[model samples]
Target chain A: MMFFEGSEKKVEAVLKPGQASLRQLGRPFWAKMVAQANAEILSSIHNDDCDAYLLSESSLFVWDDRFLMLTCGTTTLVHAVTEFLQHVSQDALAMLTYQRKNEYQAQLQKSSFADDLASLAPHLSGNAWRLGHLDGHHNYIFHLDRPYCPEPNDATGELLMYHIKGEDADYLRSEGQNIEQIRQMMAWQQLLPQFQFDDFLFQPFGYSMNGICGDRYVTMHITPQEDSSYVSFESNLPSEQLTPVLNHLLKVLQPQSYDLISFNMACALSHATGVQAIDHAEQALPIGYQMAFQHFLLPSSQVRSADPL
Target chain B: MMFFEGSEKKVEAVLKPGQASLRQLGRPFWAKMVAQANAEILSSIHNDDCDAYLLSESSLFVWDDRFLMLTCGTTTLVHAVTEFLQHVSQDALAMLTYQRKNEYQAQLQKSSFADDLASLAPHLSGNAWRLGHLDGHHNYIFHLDRPYCPEPNDATGELLMYHIKGEDADYLRSEGQNIEQIRQMMAWQQLLPQFQFDDFLFQPFGYSMNGICGDRYVTMHITPQEDSSYVSFESNLPSEQLTPVLNHLLKVLQPQSYDLISFNMACALSHATGVQAIDHAEQALPIGYQMAFQHFLLPSSQVRSADPL
Candidate 1:
């Protein structure tokens, strides 16, 4: 099978005060905008604080005045962001951050981070920075330069795993895999029992899910082909909760290498036993958010033997 | 300074028996084809075995029956290859190989490897494979699947260094640098004393050189911005000579990480002290070439502290 670009394009926007609640924009409006990105809303879960969407490609989380949307594969996320900007007053945009993780097959993407930045420039003024090495694991981020303050709890953590192994990983690549089996394997209920989940298993392979627990939400997307397997786990849960959740996933997924990223908070991961940090970078963004990134790899002895190509 | 895609696009073609010698194609003909890629031929050097042209972007080498051309930056090398194929009789083609190393900024490229493959499909039948991880250092190769034996001495070695450090790297990035100083720093006379050299020092920063010794040739390209410094050393010299040249380069450049690739031969690099191999991959190409790739990184302690972003 051909390789898929599992690394996502992510856009998060926090609106100005006195602006209309994003919820009032309605599902129909959001779905139409998402369609611009070539993705569909598969399902969604809601709580008092957020509307979490499990999309055909990835996930979207909308709060009262802010939203986080992520899409994978070759989806043109820049189009959706452009559509959203056109539908809203430019004056109402208080802060906007667009992030793209380096992809396995970047050339296949419809737009590069540079293309996206140019498309957004007409709608909003911003500055961009690249974190980490361009030849290795890295992230590109563009954010509005205006003064703004984030909430104390406005923190995000992302755990991106690569080259997964073990029986659980095998099941993910196997034909008999299903949503329920994956749920049990992940043990999300035991780990985050309060969260409600909406998930989908793609035909042949791959899986995606959205989980909401009060204002905090978590999402996971998996592409489990033997050659280029990848899993991404993201959450807005408190920093303390990030460690256990990340540890559990690492234990289950058993990836050879992984990256931990935190926004507006310090990453709480004290490297797990066999894992070693390869590179670490921290930057205080001009837009008032503190970003930290660390890439980790398992010791050679701990890594599972890969099948010959 | 903005980052340039130092990684290169390479194309090699072997002609069928009874075909006219490529040298007979003349400089004007080859220059026209290189122009199709938006690159200019800056200078050239020749010996009994080959004609090596140093282009504004990279290098080109032509032998009687075969040619190897490489171009970097955003140049559309596929276009140049297409132009060359059109000039020659299709019936004269025996085998063709196209390769692309993963770039630091792939999204900036005019065409992806996949796009190049599609463009060449009508002119040549070939199979392709990716060596190494997509998220890190990797190479995409497309080759005609036909039986052809390479001479035992028909081998090539590439040493691609990233995040270069030390005084020489600093000189390369500084304004006071010159071509003669670079040549002395590289000590080509001591290393490959028999080879004749043609070199260029780009304004402000960077360097490129072509060295020819009889039938063998060596080329080096340097991009030395502090954040994204890279140096590429390639040669058709015997395998035994490869280790010393590569070792001398690593000692002088002191890159944080690097990749060593060998075609039709084994990579003879024994791990130097403090350096560790992160990954190694080997494959026998359908076109009768043995390809081996290894990625290595210096211990964290040995790496120079990078300037903060």
Candidate 2:
């Protein structure tokens, strides 16, 4: 399938300056009113493609909702395109190709980058990301002890964020065995897709390769705006005597304002521990202290999903 | 990756004629336990490679508690394999492939009809045929009623026996809604493999020609066997109402032994009446069974599952 072969796109998004301020917007109904929320969700999808994308903007109140948190990062045009076609079963490429021809220059044909991205406009509105949760709990600690990967330079700009819980523990006194397995199982679902392109056609790639397909949890992959050459990001966290879990994220990323936003209460702690533990050895937070980026709360900007071709 | 493709097979066996017999000779747990029944069941394959076959043996239970039914069906192979490797994966072909190969000549290549059957010996065992169950009820009833299918003089020895419990009154009221569907679905699964060949790998010309799948709660393709001809079979039942069902089968198959089986058990009737209506038109029965066969009482026999090649 065309999907199996790595797509023909090579161009990356240009990260512009300034904070992409995020905020929670006022809504007519309570988030807990699932019945009401579902009705709105359906109506939005029925109104045409754009309505579905914008509904999230207005619908989002609990920035910490696991489903919302997974999509916080800047994503690639390629990932975005695939998600839309997969979810909606639409002929996305054709629409995007038409749009690309109408707006971009003929020379762009030298590369498929613009074409690939244009196809994704249908799926991404102002935000492009997903949510993550494990064992009904959002916070799970993890400690990374492995040495930095060699030639890690090429892998830069590539961020590997892992969530570990159970087996990472030193002792299996009670529920330890099951707890560790669940977390690893959850993390595999979150991380593996970024590496595998073949499983896209298969139904969730077996039970082992997937988190439970229940609506309770989800994992996402985001393509950031920068490459590793310009910027790099990494994190380190605490280890334990028994449950030796220290959450860490290493980013070999290009420098830029591009970012991802999603709702995960644990993400706050995972990053916090990493920063605190890393600081125990050296350095304070990056120079600026204006404020930490609040992911769940996006500015009430009424940006619509990219117009459908 | 290829294994993920459903070329894998199930140990399949077909029911031959005569009083149920037992084969005491112990062999590979699969074939040995499959008791030597007077009825002969053959090995059949789906797809080009006869990986899995089917059988009509009962689940493990001692003949009143002697030997165990060690022959594992689809669930057996998949789970055992999962243990051997480390995790259960998805089906490579379809969910399951039931078959019994007659690998008469598992070695040298032969072009004749005899040689072709020999290579099959490695794949199919004499008493193996896969049974695909719906929900979990093995005793299923399908009503087949069509103006008519073109009748030919000769029998297409390949036949399936569906036992029904409908009384004369019930038979008259039968709309045959289910019978037609079950036939179509089973036929399609049998014909569906052709498209898997090299030339039509992407588009399924076979499915289109067959006109099946995509529908729900329809007929289910149960099993396939190696024996293409009929052997003499017997049963004792004399009834006039049953004539239509027999006549119907005669055109499609040369049933060696046509029989009916039934018993009176209290069952509720009427979706609206909400009361247990014990009407003489006994409810429905399994997909392949006649009334005469029901009159005869037989003990559960052994089941042996073998790897048909």
* Best candidate, lDDT: 1
**Every model's DockQ, to 2 decimals?**
0.31, 0.01
- Candidate 2 stretches greater than 4 Å from native: A1-12, A15-163, A167-309, B1-309
lDDT for model 1, on a 0 to 1 scale?
0.83
Query: How do all models score by TM-score?
Result: 0.93, 0.17
The clash count of every prediction, one per candidate, is 0, 117
- What are the TM values for chain B, all candidates? 0.95, 0.19
Model 1 agreement with the true structure over A62-122: per-residue lDDT tens digits: 9999999998889989899999988887789889999888876667778788888889899
Q: Give one digit per residue, the lDDT tens place, for model 2 in B4-81.
A: 101112221212223132122222433432332111123322232111222332122112101112121122332222
Best by DockQ: 1
lDDT of 1 by residue, B183-254 (tens): 888889998888899998888778999988877889999989877788899998987787788888988888
lDDT score of residue B297 within candidate 1:
74
lDDT of 2 by residue, A100-177 (tens): 101111121222323333444454322111111100001111111112222111110112222111232112112223
Query: Deviation in angstroms for B202 in model 1?
Result: 2.2
